[model samples]
Target: MGQRIFRRVSLGIMMCVLATGLVFAGSPLPNPPHKGEGILTVNIQGVFNAKVSLSPFKGLKTVEPIATVADVRGNKSAKIKIPAQYFPGEFLLRLDYRAKEADAPYPAERIIYINQQNIEITVNPPYINNDEKTKFNSGEKENTVFSAFMKENNAKRMPLDLLRQFLLSYDQPKSKLYTEGVKEFEQRRVEYNTWLANQAKIHSKLYVSRLFQFQYIPAIIWSGDAKERVNQILKNYFEGINFSDPLIIRSRELSRFMDGYMGLYGMQATTVALRDSLFTQAGSVACEKASKGDPQVYGWMVDYFYTGYESYDIKPGITMLQKHINNPDCFTSKKQQITQRLESMARLVPGALAPDFTMNDNIGKSFKFYQWKPQARNKLILFWTTTCSDCLKLVGELSEWYKQPANKKKLDIVAINLDEPEVKIGKWKAVIANLSSWKHLHAEEGVNSPIAREYAILSMPVMFLIGSKNNVIVSTPGTIEQLVKDLK
Candidate 1:
């Protein structure tokens, strides 16, 4: 009997492993996509189950497979047709070898361009297939040009990355070595820019291809006093960008570029107040440059910049929109979106009072979030959900900290569970039971709750520190320990 049972278990295991392999062995999508939709056909090099995705994915990463296009068990070759609207834009085609399998190291993702043509790629590694040809059929020119640019970029970027790293290691204006490094870096930049210029001429039709490369120029210019060259170069750098091109607005590359640009320029500001000021000035400069060209392009950029900063420090973004987005009515549709973005942005900045709402607790008791309810004390308002594994651990840590007798009277703690109705309250209640000292409430409509929308609560678990006076938001900390330290 023991041997028979063992034999059955062994057979079951074998079947399971075989089934997993077959599933990832290049199966067709269940629902066939039409030809009009953007199609991707790849003759891959390896025979492993790989995870592929289309970008611009959120936060520069795809945590889960986007089943619509690239999330399949791609073996040696995989073909997929995307929606037609995804064309003539820049996108990243990311692949992770053995991604579905456990303990695989995440590799650097590769970016691909879409030039209103069906994409066909041959994915043999250069080492394996010496010529590194594209085995699949269409969009050969697009792939070939991009392949060369990428090859050149990698070769040239090694020195730049090392120089940039070294420059960042020292104090910016204080160190002579930093100054010397910047001067040397400019020589390399000029050399690389000349090469890029020659390529841009050859691939003139693919001018949109250069916007991202143009965006990669480091914004590390700093001076103790006003430096003419740095200012002039930055001014020319932004001005030369053809925001008149439709592709500049269609792609998220500009948005991504502006974020890093703002960070770099903001670092030059010695004070927090000055940082915000510099960021606002940078936005104005960016918008002024775009508005000087096409209204449609200008409007699109403004809308995108505003949208990008919704979860970020929104004041400078708001300032740019309000001050510089004064375009003619030709862009009426875009103006409306920008207006809506402004209204939302106006309410979500730090030091602004948090809006109030009422929600029921486990026993139907009402909890109100308003000014001065938890009198004479500051508050830590955490927007959390039970379904999130990260939130679970975070809440558990905060609960553990709350258990200490020393922290009980430190401040009032508000934990609003925004878990969907489908998720049983039992899990939420279990977490709350462990955190007995805190005021617990349920977001009546989960993530879309009125309070959540008022706060622009897109992701969790986000925390806002509220001051005692006027119930104004004091800080936004990522962890419980940070919140504790901020409170102290």
Candidate 2:
């Protein structure tokens, strides 16, 4: 009986010790053990009828909400369940609330990083960044570490950036002051990069470390003309990037980085033709670099360039995308869209037969896009919408141009309106009343309609000039002036 009593007491002691260890492991301290199933709890005050939304970054500046909680009154708390996929990445929280009883809701957003831990934050929507007004859980590590790093990083980077700028623009390169400035700038840059590298190593296990990689600035040669200096920057652009890590795609920094790189090319372009050539060359070089690193990143680079090229109607750049298109290893999410763009490039060239399609006009009369019969000297097929400001601008310009008797006799236009969401249809109807000179048709499915897919109409204000004799495309004119020139 004494032995049995000892065993029972020992088992109870073991259980108690285990519980204590678990509590201590998750205690309120820096770098506490990660616990919970990726839950975000928001406690907001100073507002009513509050709606909180949690979103994950899919691309630079593009976020889609994963969870939402609505009708949270002032001084109340609400929980948002973050799915497993979104964890281990950065997130954005948006609060929509009303300060007064009748006032319209105001929106405010805060950025936070989540790494499989329960985060509870108290915020006043209007003053979310004020330390006194808002607070996060003391035990949270991901955001805390990131915030501290950025604070120091900005402080370190300011002087270096300013010094470098001064050195680049300083007229007297041989002056003692300029030489001293260059030396100082180089010393500081080396120190900053060293600190950045150390910080990344210290936080190697944290996701925020991946972000630190972008802060690694490459060395630039201050001695040279503008183009030569830009070339030096391009040569070392990927010095600090770890392209093999797919997480770079989840950060907006990547987009900004690419934008800066592309802007370098833009600076050297003096004409439209030169700009197109430089942009395509930039795309080729950048995409090839990424292709050697990660397949997803390679696909992202290809998609980015393709989007830009399509928007600018850069046929050579569009053609350059063909090399990256057929690679099986590329995991670009925009595969279908890319394929459609390539199809448009191949089939929409001059002298090529236009795809034929029969659709009812707004008046229920059937219209054929292409046929053997002749109606006029040339036909213009315009894809547009009332919602798009650019499309509206183009249509307004074209309408005024078409008012001339000679233009009306030479060109017949078929305007395909891609307005939708039912309300836009009402607006389209109202707008087209004054635009009756041109035959109008509405595609109910917007850009996803079969006709749009055939033409690969990804964006607005696309036009095709076709000869009425055999429905062969004469040219894809970007502007009204170009259309007039093509007709001549």
Candidate 3:
């Protein structure tokens, strides 16, 4: 019985030890931890005591100033607590603190922005002497001058230097200095263009032509003497090149560039002529070369011509395009679209007679091209405008066409001007005064002209062929060859 009692006592002791181990394992030991979020300790070491109050911005629930204190300590320092939630986006942290009576100014105001992080701003008193103020102003002026010189030099080293200068100067705070800088920059562009022109002439190279192709042509067009000089130089250069010579290929390529450049200059008719001439030459060369089995050269020639034709006129462009389409290795999906656009436009071809339409003239007098002359042969009515670059570009082509036997014997050409002011009509007349083979009419009523609206004239320099019966034949703009073919 004594041994059994001893075993019971041993079991009881084991249970007590097991319970103590479980309790120790379940509960963690105590550790010395960090206090409230973080503390902002402000140390004021100045001759004057400061009054400090910190207030949190609105919409922030957790952040608030713990307290306000007066006489914060002329020799001692203080601390303030800042909550973590106040640190993001844009918030105004206002500090209204006052200095001692003898200090420069009491309650110096500071506005701080809490943006993605905390900011520490330390306040210090300004110098109390006049000599320091004078030195500060003088140094500021020197720094300003140095900064301006650096900006100007840096801008000059960049592309579009003049534009950069203008933008930089314009963005400066409004002042006489900024305004003068802007005027100077404006004048600099004129000087630069003048220098560019002289260099172009001296090099006997088509600098403006090259510039027009690569850079912005509209700016050159709007520019003064550069436009006229560039146009004259291009014309002269074009006259010098022999179109039939193989060596003249580079010069012929210039014509493609001129096609686009002329459009920008409002020489629509001339642009078209240049484009057509280049493509015709290129296409003929490619076709001839392909026949000789020079597929590589032929392909290159085909691509060059195709690009020129695409930008100029997509309809008549199809004549040369058919050869490319027939070649299995040369045609692409884009070329397929060209074929489709041509077919769609072909439905408006000549011999169908012109569509009947009433259009008001510039003077508000309504007229009809179909009714102009009932007994006239097939009439070639060109719908164009004084402002149209493509229309002006077409004049050279028209002049060439007028010399052709088929066109001379079978058709009469008429030009319709769609310029706004009545005075602009006279201007248009003067512009094309040299072309005596065509009649000119102006629609001063602008886009409101009934004729332009009826045909859905979204693009300018459109041409129409009207048959002898005054029926619309082709509404699509055609080249001289296409027009002659239709006439035949």
Per-model TM-score, in order, reads 0.63, 0.88, 0.31
Q: Per-residue lDDT tens digits of candidate 3, residues 335-439?
A: 544565455455455454345766654345767766677434767777777666666667667777687665566767766767777767676767766776666
Those runs of model 2 whose alpha carbons end farther than 4 Å from true positions after fitting are 1-37, 370-376
Pairs clashing within candidate 2? none
Q: On TM-score, who's better, 1 or 3?
A: 1
Better of 1 and 3 by lDDT: 1
Q: Give the least accurate 10-residue stretch of model 2, judged by summed lDDT.
A: 16-25
> For candidate 1, lDDT tens digit of each residue in 1-488?
00110011221122111100000111121221235676676555543455556654322333243232333443565666566544455556655555344646344245555555666765543222233443535445655676667777778867866775565445555778777888988788667666655666666565245443442443345453334423444455454466555455555555555544454454456765675576567667777767776676676556555544443444565656775456572242445445655675567557787787777766787766773366436888888887776677788888778777777667778888887785567788887886776888887688678877777665567788887567888777767777888787
Q: On residues 280-356, what C-alpha lDDT tens digit does candidate 2 reach at each position?
A: 88888888878887798888888777767766777898788777877886777667777788778887899898999
Please give the lDDT score at residue 85 for candidate 2.
Answer: 65
Would you give me the overall lDDT of model 3? 0.44
- Per-candidate local distance difference test: 0.58, 0.76, 0.44
Ranking by TM-score: 2, 1, 3
